[model samples]
Target: MSPSAVLHRQLHQAPTLALSGEGSYITLEDGRRILDATGGAAVSCLGHSNAEVRQAMIDQINQLSYCHTAYFSTKPFEELASLLIESTGEKMSKVYIVSSGSEAMEAAMKLSRQFYLEKANPEPQRTKFIARKQSYHGITIGSLSMGGHKFRRELFEPILLPNVSHVSPCNPYRNRKDGESNEEYIARLADELDAEFQRLGPETVCAFVAEPVVGAAMGCVPSVPGYFKAMKAICEKYGALFILDEVMSGMGRCGTLHAWEQEDVVPDMQTIGKGLGGGYAPIAGLLIGDKVIKTLEESTGSFRHGHTYQGHPVSCAAALAVQRVIQEENLVENVRAMGVLFEEELRKRLSDHPHVGDIRGKGLFWGIELVRDKTTKEPFDPNLQLAFKIQDKGLEAKYSISLYCGQGTADGIAGDHILLAPPYNTTREEIVRIVEVLQAVLEDVFGELKV
Candidate 1:
């Protein structure tokens, strides 16, 4: 490969180039086909190419592509926003479309603050946010401040906003006692959140932000039963808004249109992305619930934020088309049925494996945590880069599989897990291929390590 001007995620070398995609695989420039079990960070839901989404983008371009959202509202944006709101059965009264998950989260944070500011009697002191440790919301400055990932935040800690605090994530695998019931664990977590709110002055807290299913930071770790309901009760008691970051876990990736639907708790504000556009376009949005919408309506009747491409027409058209496909083909049902099989097969195959510590997730999102010792649940040293190594090795001709890998699963800087988030429309044969190839990749990696 020749040296390139494009700044890649890894500064040392350019990664493999993908020439094209179809179904659950991407064709590389080297004439190799890699099964896309990872969905490129859980973004490609309708797979890499879909005719409807492509046509929609082209149609929108033919009609109109760019119009400052501040000046005008486009049909695709309006229709997409309405579709999203109605998908929640109007539980969310409005949607503010943006270009990416980070922007959606940034909008949610500001909207959270604005929700309080637009109240009958503005409470200017309610400026703090409470998130969870071992969580990631996004990568922008504000979103980064709200996130609790230790490694991602370390370098920017000094300059990041100081108003966000964190509580223990509701991770039963690492935090729950051997015999603790779900109720006990939830009570303990709720108490911890309440304490944090009290420590910060409950009235001064704007919102409590969390992911319905924890994403990259912890690798698809869903909360224990009733965890979200209990946490939301605490936020409501203190008159604080509740925000759910479902950028990676929502949009039917977890077998529901919204991950929070399974949790039985509707957030005051919600951020969604990743699977929303299904890699058809860059699109994400903030869903505003009735409480916040009413408050803002009665006060200023406007959100105090704007982006250059807040409601990009082409992106909206692609997302709208992608969602229609998900709904039209009943793909969410497929995700549910296929996810059960995927989980059972994974557990059956890896439960007894020495290095496979935990298998957790829901719907189509699942993660396998690799450990140094299954008995002690000790993670391999971060320096080993075990998860990333497994990812790179999966690209070899023998495996030709791609896995979504993550580090810091146990704590802020330890543990490793690789996630599988294949397309919602994935079939059994593809899933079997993914699992068997993953097994082969693991065998190859451990064999190479001579462990």
Candidate 2:
């Protein structure tokens, strides 16, 4: 079948067809092999192919594919829930499974609202959610409303839900002034959030939602030191839930199972996805904290939100296997070891490039910001679409690197950056190869634009 046989995102061209995959490589229909760098938006933590995950899927398909959650609970669902909660200790006790990150985010928002309502703090006025600018929750209406990406939210602005406010993200590279210390910057952002809560009448706020490590929106930007701590303090003082959207950064992606773990603060609720099922299945989940669960249990007696595919048997089985692989193989340890190597290699190779501005990340997730002028930290013209150019060049170089395009790392609609989130179990050789490909691709593209 032709590529045009299926719907494509880039209306002008047909899509590439993949014939097979192995390890961290994908073979196109025409027999060209491309390294699966970025793991398809950082989802394939276990890489393209895993024998154990494959067997787990096959076994579950043979056993059962679907079951009504209301009538019966499957072993896979129950076991996956237990595994997730057990990893986080007693703070997290409930897990709500869903098919996609957006679905999980929707569930999390609803749960936060429901928890508040159940606590009788439902001052009806408390519906506003405070998210960080340059943040992305998901693509659904609810999650979409929570996001602050200018491009993603532009078209839907007319119909978007109201009462969602955005504050400056804790991005030191772009948001912090030249003379500011990390502490001062964090404090300033925290103060801004507190001011927003005050402006909204603190009591009228339901939650402050943010990606623990900014994901696709800002290209794997981690918070400045003490940012989350300050943010959590403000949330506590304002009586608002702290919701960490770890959908793209959690599940061992950042050298830790939970991104918030390194932040030294547990969120009231957390949304997780992508690496949750390691791209082995369509699965994502919300990790509910004890306080929120208790609020519902003691008041409403049940959550008001659920989906037909929530806790799906087959998806749960695949996720369970994925989790086991992450734990048993100590892949997260590898993420930490290799993440340092990846970042070092990136710095050594591209940090001095004329158009390369900053290289920053944690664990296996990293981002390279592209610019028009290094001294001015100026971004290329939006028309050039430098991120896409880098992506195309990488593809031509036989590396399937994904550049998460964002328009606001430098401002609200100008900066371009590329995120690299290779598999957790990637080797040193693969990391070197990825860096070589990226350097070549960037040199080729940036040279043409003369940035």
Candidate 3:
């Protein structure tokens, strides 16, 4: 390959050029068609080349493409906000739209602080945030600071904000005690969070941020039962906001419109992305709960933040169309049905593999953790980069499949897992194919390792 002008994620390797995408597969410039199982980091919930979303964007462009939210609000903007708020059953009264999950998280963090500032009894010392270890929020400085992914944050640790602290993630596979029941484990985690708040001075913390279902950083790990509720109760006890980052798990990725729906807890504020626009356009937003809205209404009456394209008309139109299509086509239902099949197929095929440690997730999002010793639940050595190699092998011409790969599930440098988040409208046949391709890739990779 010739020297590339574009600076890709990997400096040494230029990725293959994609010519087009249709349904669940993308066509490469070289004529190879690879199945898109992970939707490019779980963003393409509607899959590739969605005709409805395309038409909606084209229609919106014909009418109006850009509008400054500071000056005007377009139809798509108002309607998208209304739709999202309605979808939340009015628990969230407003939406602050942005271009990506990182921006949304940044907005959520700022809003949390702003809410406290604008309250009747202002909390000047409430400047701190709490997130979870191995959890990924986003890449922006503020969002990255709140994130606890050690591997991703190591390089920028010196420059990252010092106000954010982390607690152990609600991962049962590794953290759960040998004989501890689910209730006891959740209570223990809650107690730990309460202790952290007290140590930092409860009045000095603004909010506790978490993902209802852990995403890329943890490879689709959902919390143990009652975990979110317990955490929320602790936040309330401390008079701190409960913020949920649903960037990777929301918009029906987890068989529900909101991943929190299944968790039985409503966050005081929530950030959503990925499946929101279904990859039709770059979009994400922060959903404000009634308490925050009330505070702003009584005090500043405005969120002290602004973005050039906070609610781009085209992006809003694309997201609105995607949401409408999900409803019309009952794609969330498909997600629920296909999720069961996918999990069943994954466990049936890979559960007994010598190197496969765990297979877990909900809805269409699933992850398979690869281990060096299944009996001991030991992760592969970081030097091996097993996950990346498996992902690379899966995309080869012989396999022609794509799987989302992640590292540091066990700690921050070891543990390998493959994430599968096929489109919400994915078929049973597609689920089977994904599992088959994954099984083949795993067999080949582990066979070569002689494990």
Count of backbone clashes, every candidate in sequence:
0, 0, 0
lDDT of 3 by residue, 1-451 (tens): 3399998888788999999999999999999999999999999998999888999999999999998899999999999999999999998889999999999999998989998898999988899999999999999899999999999999999999999999999999989999999999998999999999999999999999999888899788999989999999999998999999999999999999999999999999999999999888999999989999999999979988999999999999999999999999999999999999999999999999888888899999998888888888889889998999999999899999999999998997799999999999999899999999999999898789786
List clashing residue pairs in candidate 2: none
Q: What is the TM-score of each candidate against the true structure?
A: 0.99, 0.97, 0.99
User: What is the clash tally of candidate 2?
Assistant: 0
Best lDDT goes to which candidate? Answer: 3
Instruction: Tell me the RMSD of model 3 versus the true structure.
Output: 0.8
Sort by TM-score, top down from the best: 3, 1, 2
Pairs that collide in candidate 1 are: none
Sliding window of 10 residues with minimal summed lDDT for model 2: 397-406
RMSD of 1: 1.0
**Candidate models: Cα lDDT each:** 0.92, 0.86, 0.93
What is the Cα-based lDDT of residue 120 in candidate 1? 98
Model 2 C-alpha lDDT versus the unseen true structure: 0.86
